[model samples]
Target: MRQNPERRTALLDAAIEVLAREGSRGLTLRAVDKEADVPIGTSSNYFASRDTLLTQAGARVYERLLPDEATVAQQMSSAVGTEGFVYLMREAMTRISGFRTGYLALLELRLEATRRPELREVLTKRVRADMDENVERHLASGLPGDAVSVRLLQLTLSWLILEQLTLPDIMTDEERDELVTEAVLRLSAPSKRE
Candidate 1:
């Protein structure tokens, strides 16, 4: 067995696809190995247990979808004021949609976490950290509101992402963008055109 982050990421990505398509029951270590098209025992070299694999896979899914440093920096430089905030929100939604399969696997992980207390706590802590980071970014970008506003913003975007991805045709892109823009404006509170 060799140590390779790329190999590890590939295995986790394979696991994500399995979880997304076949549900958790089918996500065996063998399935992950097969999914990655590697040797039969390759997954064992990376993950000690099925739960370990799944937990790491869940973390990987979120980790992969985080905003790229360059993009975040670019947004910070160019995106200011009400419209810029809307653009950043839109960018976030686009990222969510771009990683739809990974996000679906993430939802499966969330459900699985509920029955496993330790996993649940870990998931909660990680999710809260992500949220807190978003709030910090919002403030750094000079957007209005605090944690409450960020929560509302997250709720709004999550609902929009869920409905848009699952239902499809529930709302046109223009309509959805308008809804997101308005929600950001309301939650951000400064309203003045900057």
Candidate 2:
């Protein structure tokens, strides 16, 4: 079928909302159409089946979850150094905090992926590719971190982000920043392997 990018995006966004609010079990084409406020068949027209919708919706959620240009630039810029790294982490936190619903949907996607190996493969591929790109960016910037180190840093920050946002009173903004800063410092420190 011919495609309308705008309509597809709208349906995917609605799917994300449904996933975040009602979770994977509630992700149906009709529900997506209803969420999008389009006619009842709109989601089906865009997606072939519920599995397709779920997989594409997972991809869409991850796509939107990526950091923007400014954030990427800060992370890639050389003048920032370790301090710049901390700033990048803070910028990420700020953006993620603002996109709480999107993040929730992403978490929902992960939960759904766990039950479906095909979906899990798709997500893990995308996520690992993203992480590899992040490590390359850091290396290109002359930052000190290999893929493994960058992976550790990213995972640490991701868990911290999830907790600080999902669990109230876990840590204040400054406290989280300090924690990430420390992690970055340790990661950037010259290692025997380096």
User: Which 10-residue window in model 1 sums to the lowest lDDT?
Assistant: 185-194
RMSD for all candidates, in order, please. 3.0, 2.0
* lDDT value for model 2: 0.83
Model 2: residues with Cα > 4 Å off, grouped in runs: 68-71, 192-194
Tens digit per residue, CA lDDT, model 2, 1-194: 43999999999999999988998899899999999999999888888888888899889987888877785775566446778777776777778777787888888889989898878988899998988888888777776556677888889888987897679598877788788889988877778764
**Tens-digit per-residue lDDT, 1-194, candidate 1:** 45899999999999999988887888899999999999999999998889988888888888878878897888878987888878888999988988888877887888889887766777888889988888888777776566677888997898798887778799999998999989987887853553
TM-score of each: 0.90, 0.90
Tell me the whole-model lDDT of each prediction, alpha carbons only. Answer: 0.85, 0.83
Backbone clashes in candidate 2 total: 0
